[model samples]
Target: MSDEPAGLVRPDRRRPEPLWHQAEMALRDLIDQGEWAPGLQIPNEDRLCEMLGISRITLRHALRNLEEAGMLRREHGRGTFVRSATMVAGVRGLTSFTDEMQTLAVSPGTRLLLAQVISATREIAEALEIAEGDSVVQLRRLRLGNGQPIGIQTTHLPSARVPGLFEAASDVTSLYRWLKDNAGIVPVKAKEVYRVGAVAAGDASDLELPVGTPAFEVERITFDQRSPFEFAVSTMRADRYEIRSTLYV
Candidate 1:
């Protein structure tokens, strides 16, 4: 009798599903059942192929599907490891990171990477509707969903509009919540631009993605009833994050 793990058992040839799909399902079950815990590297490709009784090409196809689905993460030089579920956010409306995660029933977390007062550059000034060289509070943060790093975001806000923000930086988890409570600022509308790009070398480590990996560069201008109050840029992991939209024709 074979004593191999059930989740790693070979797929039945008589089944209707393709071999690659069967391999994908079997691997997913292994991860989901905690037979392969998160952050634990799975068997090497050669061994996995032997256990699953699938060819190298077939196994590679299955692995790619799992990576795209966020069930596994593949490091350039290292082996693949089980990972947390992917996070999906709707771009149809303006929502805070905290709000997005909560809606998805995932715990949201933020780590402040940098916070200081800086002069707004021409680009930032234009987006915030402020004068160039004007004082703005610059905040760089690492955003997490379910304890996994997902994005690196930087925001610039007109310092004159929100007094004492610098002193209270340590307490901020949600910028939107802080703005609303401290300065009565609420976003009436926002315009966002998304560009497909590669992750920068410096930011790749923070986001747990390889340098040159696909990423989304998002720029947003947020307005209150009075004026544009914030300008933000985010580099989010393409594997861990997705933007969903509903369309009607």
Candidate 2:
């Protein structure tokens, strides 16, 4: 196949959809059809504009949409290139990072950033269904997929419930697995909420993204049986991860 993108056809001006939207969809089709492989720099803006018969502004609008959707990556002083598609996380189950990565046939790794016993603050206590100032095991980790950092998660578990959890595992690849094996506690259900926000400085460094880049802040309270036991906050790279849900009518 040729490296150059196939010729583009000008969109209909009378269509209800905006010209930029049409252009965006057309470009998206090209990417989905594998005309532009991942990591390959696409043609320059001038070329793309000419090919699509659109102005630079319209082409940029399309490119920006794709970039935010994780289908493209634009680097300063370099060029715009195809980005690897984001990994999809189903909202149907309470699955661990390891399980999710395994299902995707990617290697899952974790680097422990912080692990200690600390007093839970009011927010943490409320999330874990414990009293303020109660002891909790705080665990912070960098989640990796295929050796690439994808997210940073911080978890707080009631210390009274899981005594010696930190001491039991020095190198924890999967907290859920360790909890099951050691404490016989398996999270059966969880209530999770997602919001979009700017990346924090520390998290941006760990996730290797620019500070203030868009991120998905996921807050989850996991339960064993009917009692909440673990509360976690995860900052995931929006460009590399997406949350998917299946709705039944």
Candidate 3:
């Protein structure tokens, strides 16, 4: 996990902006700057209220925003603590966890949640530029920042390119990063489809989403010039999340 503080570029209590949201962003910046490292319990609500010059309700709103973003977790009596930063490196850039997280100034790291060899189904084979039933390496990841869950990414790659990827699946934080380091398959272009949906039961169960909440879904097909590299499915929390892109149209 490697990310610097998210500085408050915009004040929330401005003319049209919301105070609580602005305060939340400012606090997030403080946490990202290493002012509050992960696992280190945050100051009590009363202390936070004094520091931010906000009421308890306002402070709580900001805190709740962080909790939903998966950047902070609140335990019964333990208090709020830092969560890992997740990347939203949009279709505008060709990047991996290591690249994007570093840009955001966060310590981006990965933990392999699953690695397996499976016969490529029609959908996957089509996406990966391989024939049906071809061998594919399924790599699943739980991306962390400092130490909290920020995203869940799963990839399917042709085994030929990443031989025994399943065997290499120990904490490969960035598959694209892995590609550059291991195969030199630097991506130049990628096609992405963005959608919004509720966190599935299984996803919610794993990510600890608050019973019912929406998560953004990003499906991507990475390419290196003429060939496809892999197929990916990623789910990220909507709060504190966005795909900033430039549009010419």
Best by TM-score: 1
Q: What is candidate 3's lDDT per residue for 1-249, written digit by digit as tens? A: 133224434343444767787778778887767777767777788877666667889889989767755567788867778764544444446777667766665577687778899999999999998999999898888766556576778888888888645777894666776777887788898898989877777677557687458888889999887588789998877753566554886
Stretches of model 2 off by over 4 angstroms after superposition: 1-85
lDDT of 2 by residue, 91-142 (tens): 4468888998776545788998889999999999889888999999999999
User: In the order shown, what is each candidate's alpha-carbon RMSD?
Assistant: 8.2, 9.6, 10.1
Q: lDDT for each of the candidates?
A: 0.86, 0.83, 0.74
Instruction: Order the candidate numbers by lDDT, best to worst.
Output: 1, 2, 3
TM-score-better candidate, 1 vs 3: 1
Ranking 1 against 2 by TM-score, winner:
1
* lDDT (Cα, tens digit) per residue for candidate 1, span 11-129: 67899999999998898788767888778888889888889899999999999878755667889899888876677665456778898888765689999998999999999999988
What value of lDDT does candidate 2 attain over all alpha carbons? 0.83
Give the worst 10-residue stretch by lDDT in candidate 1: 1-10
Report the Cα lDDT for candidate 3: 0.74
- The list of candidate 3 runs beyond 4 A from truth reads 1-91, 246-249
